[model samples]
Target: MKHSSAKEVEVRVKRTFLARKKPTNSLIDGQVKISIRFHQLKVRFKQLSVELNLFNNQSSDDRHIRCQRIGTRLHIFILIGSSIILALYSSLTQEIHHETILNPSETQYTTLAQVLGDCVVCPCSTFSVSHETFISIKPIYHHICSGDFVSSAWINFLLRSQFIDFVLYSDYHQQQQQQQQQQQQQQQQQQQQPQQQQQRQQQQQQKPPPPQQQRQQQPQQQRQQKPRQQQQQRRRQQQRQQKPPPQQQQPQQHQQQKQHQQQQVTTTTTTAQSVASAFWSFDNNALELYNSGLDATLSGSPIYTTSFAGYGAAISFTRSSTQYVYITPKVLPFNSRSFTIEAWIYPVSLSSSNDYGIFGQCQATSSNLCLYFIARNNKLLCGFYNNDIQGGTIITMSTWHHVACIYDLTTMTQQVWLDGSLDGSHSASAYNGLWGNTAIGATFQLGSASTFNGYIDNVRFEARAKNSTEILNDATLHVYYSFDGGSLTDNGPNGINATAYGSLSTTTGRVNQALQFSSGPYISYSYTPFYFLGISGSSFTIALWAKPTGSYAQQTILLVEQPSSWCVHYLVMTSTGQLVANCWIGSNIATNGPILSLNTWTHIAYTYSTTNGIRLYINGNQYSTTGSFTFSGSGVPMRFVLGGDRVVRQYM
Candidate 1:
């Protein structure tokens, strides 16, 4: 009857319902279960409300605080949206740029600025970029990369091992052995064939004659057989007379020998066609003057002593027993195909029996052979793998001698030259098929192996055989006028003495003394040796020191002109005071050079070859080059005129 508030009434009703409940097992259990479930639901709702921060079913003041929190969250979300929109709008409107840098500076670049976009702003100077500019990469390698397993020493060790050496060279050795076995088998078969034929003939002759023929008409048969035998013998004699005599075959044999010689010459000439020449002046070092990359290494303290008569530097091997210069044969331009080796030697001691090496390449350490040039028995000797030639001229002790050894594979000849004269020569036709490979690992030595007790200088090597004229001249100095000793005598190896036609004086030269040319004067010499220069298209160098006080229109410094042809090679000064080197075969190749200062001593050098057309150098600096121009002429007579072209009346 007392109607309280809604809450009081609900609680009073729940209590009355629970108090009035009967003790029925099923109904009571159901009601209690429902009540527990209701309580659990209330607890779970409260927990969920707390987790969500909902603040539901609370007082006004609490709800007001919850409302304020919700409003603040909404304002934060709206501000985030506005910031995102502004960034998107700015990115869409702005032009994005990227940059690339190939080589970076060493300085470290650092920045603390931030960008909202995915990429950073490029520098002002850069408009485009590569991925490499921003991206970084690191490679992860296998463990073997940091080890020494791939070093050269390890590789060489493996190569030098016995197993590797056998594997590499076994095929070559087997091939050689098989060839020898085949040759022996062929010889044995030939011998056995002739023997077998002889045995068959003997067996046939040894058999007894028929018994019936012997008994029946022995005398009659003998008489008939005698006449038959006489007729057979006469027939045999006629056959012998019909055969050609040995004298008749001599011409054919001579023809074959000539053909063989021609083939040998052709072979050697082909080998000599390569123009590779090396020179070691021994002035101060063993460096190759030709730049052929054949520089040598000295061993065992060989002295770089004074030259002959103390003029220049020369290597002295007499001081030590095991001193020598070693040149690796692998770098030699030519092998045993053809070669020429020459050296100037001043022997201080002589031995009649002991062999002394001048410069040689031995076949091996055990076999002392294969291009072994030496001085033995007080004479020079040149040796090869198959044959050797010994010099006849005795080498005097303490005297300077120019020794040269030449082997021509084409001609099958070996020659030794002593002081530019032929000292020994012999046919090496035995080398036709017997010359084995002179292995590159062979020892190429100078002044060792029974030690050359001497001074050696001016050593030269060529891939081709040198003619007598070339042998008489220095390998490079074809023409040199020292103008010393108060005469126009040549200081070069070639003794082509010059004759001055007009007033010429000797003065202090760049070296010892120089030729001073006056107006209307020139020097002339025989040009026989120069014939090869034009025909063979070989290289030549002309160098001189000049002090000029004036310039003229086309003045000649040196000239080489063919008598009947217009094939002219001249070094001249043009009207513009510029130096010019011209070579005219049928066409012309001219190289213009810088003008030389007047009244100054200037060094001018001009070099010409078919490979290098024309090169002009002033004071050792190359001024100009015309690349390669091949020019050749008929082997006509040529005249060399110095300081003027007397034939054309052009003077410097």
Candidate 2:
């Protein structure tokens, strides 16, 4: 039993040992796995240490050295990229700064430094410039630049005492007046004679037929009478049949007729006096319109007719009639060494045998000693006593022509101008007054020498000779507007001004600068002082250049309104793009002209007269009238509205 017990114990111990040994083997496997993991971790740490050596120490192994080289290359690439990016950013900043400094207003640019051989770079401020700085200019011009010829005194002397003579009356007009008065007086005498005869007859009948004759008649009446009543009735019937009946007129009608005749006479006389006085312009001293001359008297039978310019009247003379304008000699200083004579003439007929005179001043004794402007051989001839300067251009008949003769004593030159051009020029000797004095106080008259037949107008005489520019200006210029001065200023003889309203800008134009209209812009001008534009005047011309942006129902380009009438005249653009000129008299009178294209410049002109009606021109060519119209308005134009009307707002 003891031996068995011992054996069992040993077995148990072996079993226990075996179990412990099995567990120890499993633990050893786990230890090996942990060692392998630790080994792998150590290798990774070594690799990290190698990467750190790029900034620290060198490597020896070839593979380690290759790894180091790759790492070093990546580091160098990153440094190069960062440097390039920084350089690019700095360059971009500099360029942006440079561009910002350069773009701004002229006054805002200020120079800090500059090189003599290169353009100076400037910096600009963002502030706005003042309006005065933009408009004002400081000129570096000297006063000496303006020569003495432009002096006020010199200009005044050149244009002083200018005169425009209108020959409007003659003896025929006066004789007609006198004949009308005589006829009126004769009619009055005839009317009074009949009335006086009727009054005498009535008095004779009312005086009881004289008492002696009445008594004898009564005895005869009693012898023939059947009864008193029957005898009276027979006598009354015989008296009515024997006496002549008197012509009768109602008393109220006669008084009214007499009053009407008196009113007619007063009206005629007042009109005649007013017309005569209108031609006479006087100063404070009652001096003539021309400071250098006096009033002239009409002679013969010159009549007033339509003028060459078609605006006013001219003097017409017949070939056989002794019609002329007589000026008191010595009133005009024709004795001046330098003088200019100019006139517009229309010759009707020229005589081959005689010279027709436009103006003549002859000596009291000798007709040869004359300073006469005459038409000889169908050409202008200016005579200074013995010397005569003849024009080259032939004088055409019927048509209007401008003739001027100038005597410049300073240059000893004589010039003849036709139609504002120099027709002839000649050297002349100075004239010595005849009989040791001026040949004044003699026969001095226009159209007096020999015979003159035709029309004459705007006869002018200047103490100084005019230049070619002046002559051309007189012939061609009326009013001119150049909108380049930033304002609507007139560069013409008449210094008219215009006012602008609303959004009116300027742009490139057919001329230097053109007016641009937007947001209901317009220009206005008064017509008070313009006589040619008077509403009572029958002739007028309007010209304008326009560029339309769009068409509208009714766009008023020009509007002439009166205080009495709302719109006396208007030039409008219709929805159909046609230009229409309308005038209101008792009714509407309108003329439709050419169509206006959008966004294009066009020139338009309209002329009106009672005789010619309405004439519209487009771009220098006459357009076919779409409608014919006439104007008989008598209201005075108050103002001219351009680009719009008083109510309707039209943009252009």
Candidate 3:
């Protein structure tokens, strides 16, 4: 009997897979029948391999040895002996696994079943987090002969359709929902602890546990059980002193449990204590500088990050050594009167000589302006300066607390709000207008004060005295410029027209088309009403994208000048290619900036908040300080101009 050639086998496989796929009973029906067919297939595969090898002019013994190796390569374990070759085919149970990608809709599940052909797909299990059912798709190699083109084609189709995008949308949504629910439950649990503690305290107060009686009874009981207790203690000591003494593992585990329980108790107390703070109480419109809350948005500008919420499970990062978050100054509303800073914290330890800081934007320079938290006297002391406005509130270690510090410049008072209630408040001279007016060039830092072993989240800084509900309300954006329009028209509601000056140079913008300058063309804006750009306010942020083809040295980007009064170069690449942000307030130059590279399109922002001095940022990162100088803003209304000092013939 003559067996088929490799070409004939290939052709048969192709025809069977392509044409007979939908035909019922194409494969053998019963298990007994299929087993017989599989054995016949194995014998045929050996015959074809041997014939193919011999056709290639290999010796008979060499072909036999090579065929055995080939069978192993083909994933078929075949033991070749002298009399016969025992070809072991993979059984159905061994080859097919009950696994799944996801429990898709009924229609999709049915579609997958139809598409997989002989490759069986079946539901197996579900994830605990999402409770999403998964389906397993066995690799097609188990069903097809090795080196078969039919299997290769089917594999490609499965790869593209089944797993390329690999998104189980419903499963992901369910996971998020589950996570949020769990977080809510945890918050609720944290809040209830304080109440439980209070109840326990009340019960103790009512009973007034007879200390004298208990002490007397304890001595009597100890006398009665002294021998037995001493014997047990002696046995334990003996065990410890034995040769190759084993350390009791149970003590370590018990210690850990005790630590965990202490943490839970601390968190509960913190949450319970904060039930009545001004923040998380009212809803209104206030400038929210930074917020990690999903329900809240930042006030003025949109922050872009590839790691949207990589900090923790969401936007909060789990505190660890070598981990800290430095928020860009552009996103902060640092210096303000009647402002509130709020954050959720989980501290690890509190018994250090040095104070542990939670959130701070402090200038170490002479201005001495900062807003931050420090662990002092084993309590959370929110201070503006040198524990100036400290609300002496007890802050235990290993706990989560919703902490807020509010300063009202008018009242010249500082209030520390913990968990939702008023922890304490102190009236300090630093809460006056002068303290609020100080510039803070300090970095907006979370977990940056020291080796802060804690997790912080929902760090919202409101520019006004905001109750909790008011903090919830989103801030309205006043003006926004896309520079997308062909014309120099403001994209915001207020039409701030910008006309090109002498030597109007136009080049492709950083994003699209930008106002260019080869011959140093400048832009002159139409003066709006005073206070249009805030008549006199240090709490302002100026950001722009600049691509310097040539040198912007000595030339200007935007100058807020009252002629000889305050010729402030808002944003300028210096003569040395360094970005210089300075206001020449009547020759008392207050410039604090960093060196910038030329030719590269850099997003530079200069923010001047009284609390956080003039902060310079390049591409979303705070560069090193260029040293400090006092900045006194002139109350005079300054004209905003681009390019040179004048709107014409003024640039290099």
Candidate 4:
């Protein structure tokens, strides 16, 4: 039989072989069957070869075919070789032609499913191919079947898409990690907060109890226990009251109670006593001046006596002669220890040699007495003349000034305060000396035996046996006046009928009354309208409270005119509410200080010295200037003026 197709040949070979194998088959038949089967096989093989040859002939120059045939020996080998060669050729051709798909399994297939996971079926496994599987199968597909170029293209697209998904996933995972960390930190903080709060509460609870709580507990216990003691005291008192029936004992008890009451009253009165009275002025009436006697002498201006001028007395002497003035009391008191000697004097001349103007002395002999006055070179000398240990320098121009000498025995120290400051001091073993007759002789004159000339007024001697602090605390020299023919009345020395000028009244405190002046002219014949509470030529402070009624043309409060050329004036209200001070030496107002306020009550103070010029203090503020003035020949023998001039009106 002639087989036309390869398919027919294959079929004929199979049928002939099966027919020969039946039961009752002849040798010839079998042989024929075998020959036919062999022929059919040969034919089928020839046809296959022809088809392959034709396929090869179509692309003769193709190296892929040559390679595929060269290695095709066994059937499995031909199968694998042909498949691999075809796949390789397909891949090469697709790549050359720029085809999208070359292989189905591999063929460099890139599909969304394969690159990520194989959603389509994977022929080799029960599960679908995952991204990892796809990656593994990729090289296999390149070496095996060649089909579905689209799968390869899709794989590449899926790989690009997978890269984008991977980036997003990574970002999301990082954000999740950060958020978790933050939450964990917050949780840790929350866990610690309760512990901190508990610690604070424990500290607050452990604080110490308040003072009020402790006090309250103690007081409550005391209050509960006090009632029983009170009840016992009441019972005792009742028993005593029922048994008190002795008349004589009652009288004695009554007298004792009265005496106890008196003692209590006395104690109360003493406790209530004031210290203000301790500073009261001394009794000036107790003092006496001995001017003409064996113990003392009198000289020029003998009219200036303590009897005549209340507290001031003066004695003058010339260069050729000597004079003295002394006081002797009827009773020589022994307790005259702490004393203050204040005097106002003008030195007419200063001696080159040491001069003595004895103020007070208890002298049985000349060398054994205590004395005080200006020494030679114008220094103040004070202490026992026999052995003078304590003294001070008084370097002032020859002029009139007020000087006060205070001696305190309790402290055993002598303090000489100039103006208000301590200028000098001395220490002594004892202040008490032998009591002798107090006297002033020719050697103890005012412008003493050495011819130092001047006038003196307002000499006050106070015996204060107490310490200085005690004496200052107890007594004050309240008032001082030089009665130069003026009535001793409550109204001041400037008379009531006087014009614009006013006067000091005695009705006020015992001290010297302040005189005020208005803006009109008031004249008087007697220049010494009010006695001048004079001062000696030394360091001194002049202070007074003054109020001006109106502005004045010329208002003079105090003036000093010397015999030769020295003059000083304290003028107030020369201008409205203004104070003027002028110091003249040798007929020239060498220094004219600035004026201060006068409208209101003002305390005006002037501290003057020959070495320090003049310092003015208004209400405690100091005033300074450049000009200097000095008394040249002798000190001024001038009287103080309240509202007018000393000698005459318009004396300036």
Candidate 5:
């Protein structure tokens, strides 16, 4: 049993040993596979390194070959490019030459010798275009030190290739220069032509000696022209007797002639000065709108010279139906060819649809020659009717505005100036309206066309075409009234006295002393005819300042009445203590209810239009309104009676 057990143990140990051998062989096989793989990998690495080195050497040689091929190709390209460039250069040169042939001398370019120095030793064939050549083409590149190389053959060729382009633009620059020169020459010629024409005119204007017989003129004129003519005769006689050297006598004779010419001009001017003496400048404190020039005073003095003159006292006219200034018709020189009329005016009130006369020698409504302010359109009409009244200007009211008009009979041109600016111009084709009917008129008048409502200062009427500057700065005025005297005195040569109508009181005012109308007459039950205040048309506005003395029994502040004509325009009132406006037109009457409180000074305005009828405003704000009304009854001459109605035989 022990032997059998021992055999079994040996068998088991052998089995164990066999199993261990099997595992060891597997481990040895795995290690052998790993060793073979490492050897194969190392060999593969060496082979790869050898192949990599060979590829590197071949790539280096390939690069060298590529470089040689590229260099050879570049040389070929350069040769081909040179040929193409040469052909282009030839073509461009031909084209430029063709253009130069067509326009001839009209376009000229800088010659080759001008652009490049005259290098006779260098053949143009030696020129070749390159990057350097193009660099030279840049204008600023000229500063580079190319020295004489710029005149070399290739540079000359490059220039020749682009010569047409440069020449074409250069031709334009030349044309511009030529045009400018030509224009300057034309301007010079034009300026010289006028001067030459003026010289010719002066030469053609030489006049023959006047007739020995002296013509009729004013006393001042006779002395002036007579002496001037005698002096001119004496100068001519001296020129004939002196027999001086032609050279020396030329300047002396010219100087004397110039002086003599000036004297002659002064003499002729004096004749007009004598006539200008007929002009009326209201400078005196007289109740008359007098003519200091003609020594003839105006007919009626509804106005007076005030102490408000900037130069002297200005003429103050009370806007009245009966007051108007007039000069006798026969006094004006009818044969005078030209006339300048001007004045400075300050409009106290400018209402719509009213005409404030500035001055007139004829009927204002008939399109005759007249100057007036048309309040409807807010325009100044300097009317000179050859056939119809025409020329005018737009002028702002309330502020001081200077108005002037010039009538040149020779040219028949009428120019209107407002506030030192030319307003408009028109041609007067006929003479009958302005110059022909001088004797038939009632009188040359100032103020109150119907009624003029403003102050007039520096009134001027001269028979000469004077510009605004000349008129404003005139040293020798036709009529001048300084208004420094209490009585009317002629400041001009022709001193005419004017008649005073109504009594006007002087009071301390804006300047020296202003004419003051009694407040009782202004706000009480009295009314002035106020011809200038006659509201016309279907639409009108009434604006005024009123200080209430604590409303008195439905007091009528203002009223418009036409006596027995059955015409009533408005009746403004202070009812209780409230302000109200009532308007009547046609057969309809409208009321703009109570608007403002009384007892305090208030500005009340009522606008009446055919469309809206009536609109009431208190202190510039809308207060009440009314419906439309169509005005009729021959459009009565309605005066906007302030405070009460005492005109046209009516009452408060």
Candidate 6:
């Protein structure tokens, strides 16, 4: 069998093929095995040959190309088959994990190639399937596989479920946050409430007790304490009484005490005469008598004297067609008696001789007496008249003079004062008699006859009169105004027509003239508005006499213009008794109470100032007031109107 190498190999191959073909079914099986073996052997021998060639010739490009081509083909085939198997396994696992296909039915064996191809991007060797494949597939493979095996309903269900879960979670979180905020606010309020309550309690504790309770207890405490004070006072008094008197008290002390007692008695005597009767009659039997003897030229005429109620006597001298006659009265004694004589006189004509008409005498027919009066030539005279001769001085008689003759018994000097001023004085002789008489006769002829064509009233004669120093020292005179005619007029001389508001009338002697207004018919020449004086400072006080006929439509009682300013000073009632004073200082306004009444005379006064604003008085009592105010301008002007203006009213 080993004839030659080539012949022997060929013979063996031929013999093996014949043997395999001899047994038919067995031959086929053997052939198939041989083919598989041939294929494997061929692959192995080719790899061996390439390895041998690579070893023999290292730079052969042809053999390398053939080997790379075979390897690439095998890798492609293996990748395709593996991707199919992995895709099927991944699908089954995803279905089990998501529970979408758990307990598979008839659809369990479905192909997974389409799902894998739709889910995977590249099906080459680089592709891989994993458990996180579903998330990676949502954007790309979800829409892609939606038209393939997966239903749109399933995808929509999944997406809707996820959105609802997100919404529910967000709402729950927000609700929790709100609840937390509310709890924090509640805690803060709880903490502050106690503090507020504590503050309220503190305020209540600090509050004072009611005024009524304090007032109710005050009097009781005072009553209980008063007895103790009284007891203490009594003890002090007893101690003082138990002490002995000092022995060092001298006779000077005794004398001082006696002098003090005498002073007290003198003060009591003076105080008793403080309120003297206004109707004290003049002593006609004084030493210096004006009409002493009955042998005077006025003996044919009746004597003139004042009544108790009347102020002065009106003496009439008859005129035999205007002629003058002389009359003289007997004088009496005078010794150290201080005397004063005052008379109000009005003459009809002052065209006679400048001689003595009315005189006061001290001796028989005027031996030594002071002549203090006015003469016919309008000259004032004040000196002594001696031995029935007028020799002192002379004053003119046309106008009236408030003549006052003061004789100082201590100084032994005679002085005359006119209208509250010292006019003249002279040395007087000493006389013994301290009584006198006065006379009225044709010597003081009226209208050039015994018929005196003049009037005289308010004649006053005082013996032992107080001096100016003594009168000025009186306290009553300072507090109240004197009823003398110097400050006010109760009645004019010779029963002249005059009246006062809110006074004791001369006719009735009762409280009358509370409210009054007067309006009259026109007169040619007369004084219209009345006069008021003695007003000072910034206060406003209005007092007048008003006689109203009927209820007037518009009546102005008082209107005071402010000095250099445009504001009204006061407004008084003419139709009614109301009194109001307004002071505009800068920008302030002050008002007083009403003082109104009708058809009667009233004394209404208003006091307004910057400090003591306004005070209203009816009669003599203060009625109402306003608090203090500050004034704007200086004050009201001095010249103001009362009643009605002549140029405006044209009536009296």
| lDDT tens digits, residue span 199-302, model 2 | 99999888767788989899788777758778789999999888655544365566689689657545433111001111211111122354333455555656
Off by over 4 Å in 1: 1-275, 309-311, 333-336, 365-369, 429-448, 475-652
**Candidate 4's residue-wise lDDT over 574-615, tens digit each?**
544345665544553433444544345555666657676667
User: TM-score of every model?
Assistant: 0.33, 0.36, 0.26, 0.33, 0.28, 0.27
lDDT (10s digit) by residue, model 5, range 207-288: 5435442243356577788989999999999987877768987888877996895564443221211133233446664222
Q: RMSD, each candidate, Å? A: 29.5, 42.6, 32.3, 51.6, 32.3, 57.4
Q: Is candidate 1 or candidate 4 better by lDDT?
A: 1
The CA lDDT at 36 in model 5 is: 86
Cα RMSD for predicted model 1: 29.5
Residue 285 alpha-carbon offset, candidate 6, angstroms: 20
Count of clashes, each model: 5, 0, 36, 39, 21, 43
Candidates ranked, most accurate by lDDT first: 1, 2, 3, 5, 4, 6
Error of 1 at 44 (Å): 99
- For model 1 the local lDDT of residue 463 reads 69
The TM-score of predicted model 3 comes to 0.26
Cα deviation in Å at residue 612, candidate 6? Answer: 27
Runs with alpha carbons beyond 4 Å of true place in candidate 3: 1-478, 503-505, 528-537, 563-565, 584-586, 590-594, 626-630, 644-652
